[model samples]
Target: MGIDLLTIHWIYLIFILLIIVFMICKKDTSLICILGIFVLGVVGTSDFSVAVMGVFNSFVFATEELMGTILIISVITGMSNILLISGINETMIYPFTKIIRTPSLAYWIIGILMMILSWFFWPSPAVALMGAVLLPIALKVGLPRIGVAMAMNLFGHGIALASDLIIQGAPKITADAAGIPVSDVVSASIPLNIVMGVVTTITAFYFLRKDMKNGTLFEEERAVEDIEDKDCIEKNKYKFSKGTRIFFAIVIPLFFAADIVIMYIKKLQGGDATALIGGTACFVLVMISVLTYREKGLEKITSHLIEGFQFGFKIFGAVIPIAAFFYLGDAAFGQIFGEVLPANSQGIVNDIGIALAKAVPINQGVAAITLTTVGAITGLDGSGFSGISLAGSIAKLFSMALGSGIATLTALGQIAAIWVGGGTIVPWAVIPVAAICGIDAFELARRNMKPVLIGLIVTTIVGMFLI
Candidate 1:
């Protein structure tokens, strides 16, 4: 049975294209997504009320699909918050500061440390942890604030969050949407992540060195003395018994390091890896909270949990609606619509892929470029992980059309989405880095654009070869 082009929901295609256009214009697509769902529902059911109901249902569907990711990020964040308040975060990074003797070393060391920490605690919290402790050191040692921001943004958000190997949140969303195992996406992303990380960082560093030599990279004249004094006082206020801080600082890394080992030895890929990490994070949160706030531990735990959920849902709020619209392009369409789609229905994205496969000449190169573009567009909402499900769905569609490399294509799209919106090149997304570094977010984004775009292009071409 062939897909009859006439039977396809051409309006679905139009909605997707409209979304891309909206993204290109740097506008939020949440309202546009809801409108798409309404249009698609009305087209499918011809009932305005049913269509309205479908809108709510689609959100419910997306929440259900993304709950695991949301929960994992929340738990990890709560754990991170505990570490922060307990002063364990500072303890963890203290030793690393010893190695940063030069401006160049400060840039790379901070970046590497941020990458490692972000892999476990995520970039947002990691930024706070490292920035508070190391940013001053970097500044004093002659690394410009913009250079520091570039390093943190590139390594933490760009490399770490983009690939997101240890936590596996990004890949889980992508793999689920692509109907593949998380390991495949992880494995495929390794090469792409390396290419992007190495190229972007090295290129950015070279430019940074040139600017510094040309005397264009002047240090921002802020109250460094006051900030350092205040930070020292703050650290003193949170001083756990040296033993407690030392104990947790060691235990935390050991626990996560063991999780990595267990994942490798036990082959606990995908959800299992994420479950291990989340469970460990929760355990650490409770352990640390009880030890530090013993009398008020229970109440404190609740507050920590509330903050975690707030952070997680805050990011997910914009995501769920967009995901809802894209979920319509997959098998979930039937459930979202509350009606049985046609038997053998390939869904909207897949249908488009099939139509493209039949109508146009597409190869690995075209498919790579298309998925990368789609991923980048979905990323315009500025929550990097939010758009991954669509990328995964499109990867699956394109893979089905091409008959191979589902994982590779999915990974490619994942990189694109995260790199663009994971807080690297996107202005709004880079605000945290910019604000922390006291630089303009747009300037940071401008500094990042060349390296990230070049990295993406190089990675895409390399991905074409791999695929």
Candidate 2:
């Protein structure tokens, strides 16, 4: 059965399209997102005051949802800053520098390592940890920070997350909704994942090399690129023994390595894993501050933490408005603004996905395309996982009617969802990477767009044949 699309749904869709157009035109979408939220508020409640308040509440909602990631990034950045000020980061990255002597080596090495770690710890936490270690090495080897970001994002969130073999979170959701075994989805995803990962990463690399060669890639917008750019030692203002530097360098990785072990044995994923890493970063930051600064440690630790948070909030401040508006298109709308969706509706984005699926006829080719389109639409909510069940449900309907290709269709939908919303093309979704790389999130998203779009098209066509 097809669900009725409400006025709010149309409003949300129009704004989403507008946001995409604005993004393509390289315009900031914060005002557009704020207007979208206010319009949603007005359409839902029919009250001017409530509409204005909705924008504020939506910001609060996005912050609450994003707090964990923000905290982790802050502490990590704080720890990074202290390491920079103390000169520990140079020692920490010395080994990696030997191995990553060239830009090509740096790109592939960081990417592969990120993929392996993300398979275990998931992308968000893994990135926080990996960026602290590998970023300097990549930067030193002439790989741009955006290049490093692209490598990690592509290999981690785009590939490992889409496949999700270790965690099985994404496939489990889609498999259950599609009425298939998780193994079926996993098995079907292997080839498609390889295609998407290889094609997208290679395509992205090609552009990176071309622009870098032509001197077109820009990183100069920032006052400083990263930790390494500044004098590694402010020796006049701060002093630490070489032993202390070496000690923390060893301790830092050991502690984070222990975190990975604990995560493995405990079967922690998502927020739990993120909390584990964040807590470790906090502990390390305190230890370094106290041990390095001695009498002034108490005061210095708070200052370092303040700097970290300032940096985290700075990046996220620009993002909350956009994230707030997208969160409304998902289950968060009811929680934030009250139960205003129509009786037959399945939330705003889900309704749109179902409507799109219903408008199409059932066949193998149409099924593949519809599943991909539905998955991408659902992913527009930007959680990546939010509306995938709808994709699975629609895939099941088409596959059963066509009498084959359920697994292929299901996997196809999962890929499209994660690729678009997990961390690739969505600017807000890729904000953490942009923050870490110190690049504009919109520009990062734009760099990712062409390669990802091309990869999706090729992968969807491949799935059609498999179906």
Candidate 3:
């Protein structure tokens, strides 16, 4: 019953390495992934026609696996859009701006609020919400617009997404790929998340403070001019009662918070937690539309839903093919291609991991570092969640070889992926934050690089101890 390491699938190893190289060159991997599927299919089925068919089937399989995540994100986005249109999103954060009267306070308060909102509504929508309401206030209090962008990018995309505690989208992907319970991933991520969040945020703030004291925190002249005459006031004022704004502003958070409570009490972990969040978002979307638009709400609801789906699928389009290639390295290969792999078959990634363990003698430190590097490399495509399944699969393989700490390794990889590609360090990924604050995305990413890198190093070290 011994597996033949020598007879292992070399194509998988080749394609995986190809993917890493492609990502490092800052190129799209979707076409590369499709090529991987075709080659794997040809080899697996020993037929060229089946291989061609496999390309389409692999995408289908990837979509089926990812449908829940896509739906939840879309629905949440719809809820957020409706809130914005109804003015509830602004009302939610209006009170917090009163506490930020100084630059020092502005940094922490804006960062904290961004993190909290990102956890519930996700980083993209949360950035739009916080940016419009908090940016002008931060600027008025003498915090530069770049400072506002940094706080939003780091806290919302970096910390909140790296942890992903409330919605569980990131953890769900990692956990499923690792073939473990979602709770394990969530539980393991908490400590690493805290370390990364605290270290990065504090380090970033320290630098910002130094820059301010040295008079080096000057805004880009063009950006300053652009927003100088502009205020953060909502452009499309609605006649909706103030009570409606306050009502939803309070109710939405309470509803999602209650979902978290129920999840914990009922031990509703994986798809169940996703279902709760998605269902709640849909209900809120309906309520907000009906209350705000009345009869017109019916038509408005459709438009919101359409926009939500558009955004969700746009992200998914980049992710699915990449995921398809990784899925071929797992049990899903059997289901996807209509063939049962050999009884003793080890999926390609696991096989490569085992070979690595044997050839290189990987200890926990080495394993942790490798996972982090892989995660960071996969993140080069600028979509943080896209490459997480690869991280999870590799973590599982390494854990099997090392005999412990699956969750910790998975969490470390998750944190690295999200922080780098989620928004903080990736130029393209930081667009939402940068655009909202009217700063340059590259500049925002450059500002975030040092703090995020240091945090990753510290977090990896902490992960070693935990493991």
Candidate 4:
């Protein structure tokens, strides 16, 4: 497991430099990752032939690993997009406006709704739906666009997508790496998620309320200020056919409940649960598209799939290279690249990580914090999945080296990765919500920064104890 010092120093230096440049310049991570792979491959293999293959191999591995998640995410998003065009998303939220009579109530109400929908449908689509429907109502009732964006980001992206309780994708990643059941990861993560969610939400509310009070100077004018998304309001006036409403309302929940029950009964965990969820999502996607489109189902099906792929690729294209570099820190992929280098040299990337851990000798507390910090940083690239992949790999490496619970470590890492990069803390991730609400993404992220940082710190501490 020991790495040659000569290779370690050079590889480590190069990785650090690339990372610094990436952070400072805000360049595309994919290019940075490709460069890392090429450099590492050349150094490791010392053969032009192997170095060339290494680049192709990096992309191949990323495609192989992420293709399914990307497909499911894209298709589901596309389906939701179709639902939006049909005004089903608006129909779904109209009822909430009545119950949520005030701005405060709207904040929590939208947060919970976004959380639920996000768990099933994901944040990208959920945000679109929420933005199209709830945002105007929220603003009308005195909720700032910033507040609306913050709620969607925290609830949909941070709480729901991070947990991915219904979909099981995030849990599967951690569970697979830990060689544990998905159920165990799910069960453990729920409590952690609740703690994180409540703390973050309350903290956010406090800050938001104060801002609202201070900004009261323009209360009358702002109150009259229309969000200009009059088109969404017009769309909501259309009534959903009773059958469509009744069918989806009952069917969606029932499908998810069945999955939960089946998973519990079978004690299914990891890939089993993920396959079950993925399979169910695909079935539902097909059935729903068929039911809505009817005789034209074939073409509609193709359209939905195409939409899904476009959305998925848009997300994946941005994050894949970062994943490739992080994979270097793992023995599995690292060993593949390491073989290309000096025959006698050990995997430099893996070795350097271990050596640094040993050299600094961080305690479990500090290690947890470090892991969380690293996950948050990677999320800056804006695709939560890439950050999760990188964080999971790091967790596996550290857990093995430290003889800790990989499941716990991976879950902790997943939380940090998603919460930060998943959308709340990143301007790019908040763009949809911001654009839809006619607000600024940077301001949205800045508004969310404090709550998210606090939540991360608290969660990291809790993870140390739980793990």
- lDDT tens per residue, model 3, 287-313: 888877788889978888998899899
lDDT of 2 by residue, 1-467 (tens): 22223678778778866765664454666788899999888878878898898899988987886677667667777776676667675566556557887778888888887887666446775665567667876776688888988998899889988997655667766765566777788889999999999999999999999998899964332233343324334532665677877887787778878987998899765567667877887888898888768899999899889988897787566557766776776666787778777666666655665665567556677888878887776566555665455566667667656668989999999999889878988888898877777679898889999999999999999999999
* TM-score computed on alpha carbons, candidate 2: 0.64
The lDDT of each candidate is 0.85, 0.76, 0.83, 0.71
Highest lDDT: which candidate?
1
State the weakest 10-residue window (summed lDDT) of model 2: 220-229
Across 1-467, the per-residue lDDT of candidate 1 in tens digits comes to: 33333333677778767877887888888888899999888777767998899999999988998888899899999988878878898899999888887789999999999999999888998887777888888887889999999999999999999889888889888887887888999999999999989999999999999999999888553424322322365346555887889888998899999999998899897778889999999999998888777788898888888989999999888788878887888777788765545666667677777777788777999989988888888787788877788788879878877888899999999999999999998899999888777789999999999998899899999999888
| Model 4 Cα shift for residue 145 (angstroms) | 3.0
- Can you rank all candidates by lDDT, best first? 1, 3, 2, 4
Clashing pairs for predicted structure model 2, backbone only: none
Off by over 4 Å in 1: 1-8, 219-238
Superposition error at 449 for model 1 (Å): 1.2
Measured with C-alpha atoms, the lDDT of residue 299 in candidate 2 is 92
Every model's TM-score: 0.94, 0.64, 0.94, 0.85
Q: Give one clash count per candidate, in the order shown.
A: 0, 0, 0, 7
State the lDDT of candidate 4 residue by residue for 28-136, as single tens digits. 6666677777777776666777767887787777666566566667767766755664555666677787886677888899999999899878887887678766776
